[model samples]
Target: MQLLSPTATTYSELQNAYEHFNKVLFDNALPACLITLQREKRTCGYFSAQRWANVEGQFTDEIALNPAYFAVTPIVETMQTLVHEMVHLWQHHFGKPGRGRYHNDEWANKMESIGLMPSSTGQPGGKRTGDHMGDYAVEGGRFLMACQALLTAQFKLSWYDRFPAEEHVAHGQASYASQLSDPAAAISPAQANQALANVVKPTVKAARQSEDGTSLQAPNRSNRIKYTCPSCAQQVWGKPGLRLLCGGENCDSIPFV
Candidate 1:
């Protein structure tokens, strides 16, 4: 399907891209799932199990891409996010068990088999974690190659404009939380748009106080620990006493303080 324009925002384009990638990359092995665009902070895309229920009272998997994040990202990088979540979905359905947020070796191996080597730092090589490691995709990997091929074939891909600009909020500012009482009943497109219209945007505020009434402050940069990738000179900073990897798909350099 050819897109009407480079900046189109039609859902059909997204669906077509999903179907195309499923056929070309996964050999049509992945099951069908609901794909939606959401306005998420920080997260580029997410894959959740059984988040939506259909008219038949059966739960279905969901893959939500953050339009706010993707609007400014390169098309190739956007495809990377999609493929990354697909990898997660694949792992969740068929691969070995993974604990929490850690992507196990089996997951990494599967990702590599598809031409997306995981790097923690978005670089080239990454640290080894009991044989597998968390990683981002490498440049010129299979995933990118596939995306280029699809584009070359004139596949339609749509990306919308960025969300309206809001007041800048520092990282780790106010915390906004929500709970799902129950799966929402399936609704039509009109109903969905009405529901979205009624949603209130969250506001950012200063950090909250602790139990003892002490005001929270941002972490001290001096006291925090830092990790450096020997190969690419990439630096990651975080709380003290934690080991980190260079996170580069090709570099895979062990981090040092």
Candidate 2:
């Protein structure tokens, strides 16, 4: 894997990571709904964090892990976090609303599909991108603590509600606290618009190097992932067995890959 200099992770660089990882996860058969990774605050784990956007039916960015918590986060923990968040995204898009996103048989089945288990928190269970899910069980504590201060008093409620419609909207804004933390909301609607244009679609291209040093370009096929904008209901394509786009040029809704 290639190390991205702190200086190199500009918005464009972030977009590249978004494209690359979406393709990677999808190609691996665990396609996510949406993904973004940026240097944002109040998120835990790695240099980034991820969550499901219920209202938008996609996954949020991998918010960078605060430097203070990096030591304990193992590779498996990070992969679990990614898979966990992606499963939530899948539920939001493909599964019915009002369904529990975690701690249920569906979650277990999804985790199993990805070689993970909800009960495997910090315990030996399955394979991930690497072997290290225990890191979150350790490192995630501080982030949860910090998030308590940065997040709303009812952060749990901020995620979902029993009402299917409300649950959808609530999950869409997991980053609301982080967005508020921003001295400036540097991620503009225009920039988000640009990103929506570049999400993966079925096409053949030469294998190209990602910041992570892996090549993500893949062969085109009919079974590619498809998405319908939760906001607009416009159908679009993604990495395979996943959706990638919304209708409007400036889509604030979540996306998958």
Candidate 3:
């Protein structure tokens, strides 16, 4: 047997997660960025704008996840930190970013649109935007659907840092956080919505099965869900595991991909 390739197993998993989340949550609109493991004390993770460039002069933003807290926090919770930074990246490229490290209203709204609620304390009713902030996963939200899809596909980070950080936060609703992070509907539209809301039915997809050999149950939502308002062409993306329609004013068209 060949020895395992550590970097391939580790970093590549994060890269895959970034791409997967980009498609599922952001309508594949967010630009590609760097995913790095960092050891910053008391920091779960961070997003630095235009932090790196290749010899060819391509610049990409950087998202550094503190590996120290990986083992202390649930894996899904840790992934939540990754996504929190991703929201910063989203604002940096597509929306108005707050000055310095402050999280602005646009970023906060975007986070809510994606089913991640901003909070200063990482829980409900916490401040929505600030220099220091965290988020909790929303019930029956897009982020949960995305996470379920990833899990159904058997994607995971193969390696984790041995040392943990001092500051640890359980950033999502873990079952809520899971779809958004490691915890589970476990990530598709149906079961993810069902798991989060207990409404939609779950489906079975390609994957490793249970001990009895039955296929595992997953969410109903698939990847790359998009909707466009017919009258205004106002597009929106999400995977709520519910029937989607163009919700523009006077444009309630019930069509989608």
Candidate 4:
């Protein structure tokens, strides 16, 4: 695939890619959903099963891509991240069981069936994590082949300008709040929470709160837990078992603690 100028990728571009892949790779089995560009601190991408009412007052599914993470990544790798999350969306809609942050056996089977093999180490044939695994697009896999075909067809994946100025810009350097001016950028967490409130009832909230008044948030991401790279000591805010790799280009091979 010809690598185009690394200009900022827009959310519309992401949606285009999602649609193309959904039709070609998934035979268009997946339903329509919201495609967004998120400035997530840790993960490369995310798929939410929780439905929410958008600004138009219509409920929709959500798939969020982290611009900060994908800005420095290769386009093919970025496509892989999108496909990976699509698998999650597929599982959620198809009744595949997953516990918390773990990518269970059923999920793995589905991933493999779609040409992605999960590895905790982000390498082909790396150590597996029980029945669950994470990271790395399998080399010579069906997903890779499909991406290659798309690239051959001259599909251009746009990049997102995660920063106001490109100077001294490395990956994951800008904060989401600072770059809300972009129309295609994902909604901020506060906006997401507000939107979710319209769909998720208060009874669900009561069940998640602790006796001490603290609320149990998402499984692998919480204010109480922090992820730090053992090599560079670059700390990212998230819970343990999040599969967070060091954001440093050179130290990315090292998993965060």
Among these predictions, the greatest lDDT belongs to 3
Please write out the lDDT profile of model 4 over residues 213-253, one tens digit for every residue.
00011332232344445456576754333455566977746
Better of 3 and 4 by lDDT: 3
Per-prediction backbone clash count: 19, 22, 16, 5
Two-way TM-score contest, 1 vs 2, winner: 1
Give the local distance difference test score of model 3: 0.58
Worst 10 residues of 1 by lDDT: 174-183
Q: Highest TM-score: give the candidate number.
A: 3
Summarize candidate 3's per-residue lDDT along 32-133 as a digit string, tens digits.
888887665445678888989999999999888765445434455566777778888888888788777778899889889888888776657778877777
Candidate 3 wrongly placed segments (more than 4 Å) = 1-4, 165-257
For residue 218, give model 3's deviation from the true position in Å.
36
Instruction: Score every model by TM-score.
Output: 0.56, 0.31, 0.64, 0.56
| Candidates arranged by lDDT, highest first | 3, 4, 1, 2
Over 4 Å off in model 4, which ranges?
1-9, 54-58, 125-133, 162-257
User: Model 2 Cα RMSD, Å?
Assistant: 18.7
- The CA lDDT of each predicted structure is 0.50, 0.31, 0.58, 0.52
Candidate 4 Cα lDDT to native: 0.52
Tens digit per residue, CA lDDT, model 1, 96-143: 646655666786787787777665533444453322233344445666
Error of 3 at 81 (Å): 1.6
